[model samples]
Target: MHHDSLHALLVKEKLSLTRPRRIIFDLLLHKDPQSMQVLISRAANKVDRATIYRTIELFERLGIVHRLNIGWKYKIELSDLFVGHHHHFHCNQCGATHTLQANPMLETMIDTVAAKENFSPRSHQLEIHGLCGQCAGQPA
Candidate 1:
């Protein structure tokens, strides 16, 4: 999404488009998923850790981003409201994360299971944690 549109979103939410928030938003806008450490280090204007953490918490609370917990740590990215429904391949060895495209077969399986259990499903998330290509000693 455009930065202007993001600004408008903040306006609609009656939230201030603060400099730290804007920097964090732009970071998530381009990348897929990023760790807090990566975000703190990559922020252009050197936003402090406490401010970035608070911004991330705020975004998650507002449904603007999804927090994918990796053990005690986590990564943050734009939620499905802004992006498409998909899964994640998280590298256990190196902590790298790669996006997995949405699969129709998986959707079919989920629907089948829900029908069998008579369950009403609203939303779901999947994260496959293992060694990524590079960590597995192959091309990434």
Candidate 2:
């Protein structure tokens, strides 16, 4: 989404457009989903860890960001509200993440299961963990 839209969203949510919050949001705007530690490091001491952590938590709570548990750590990214729903392929060996757009087959499977169990699904995330091409070619 555009920066102006993001600013508008903050206003719509009644969230103050603070420098720390804007800085972190801007970073996420440029980069893909990032871990808390990576976000902190990129801030380069311009923002404090506690503030970044707090802002992240607030963003998640406000549906401005989506948090993914990639087994080892939590990664934060823009939510479907802004970017649309998607999935990821995480390379377990090198800690790389590749975004995957919505798949019809996967969606059908989820819908079938939900119907079978009489469950109303709200949202879903799929993270496929395996070796990337380079890692797969390397001998153990």
Candidate 2: where is the Cα deviation over 4 Å? none
State residue 129's C-alpha deviation in candidate 2, in Å.
0.8
The digit string of per-residue lDDT tens for model 1 on 79-113 reads 88778889999888887889999999997788788
Worst 10 residues of 1 by lDDT: 1-10
Model 1 gets an lDDT of 0.84
Error of 2 at 87 (Å): 0.7
Give all TM-scores, in the order shown: 0.85, 0.89
Question: Candidate 1, TM-score vs. the true structure?
Answer: 0.85
lDDT of each: 0.84, 0.84
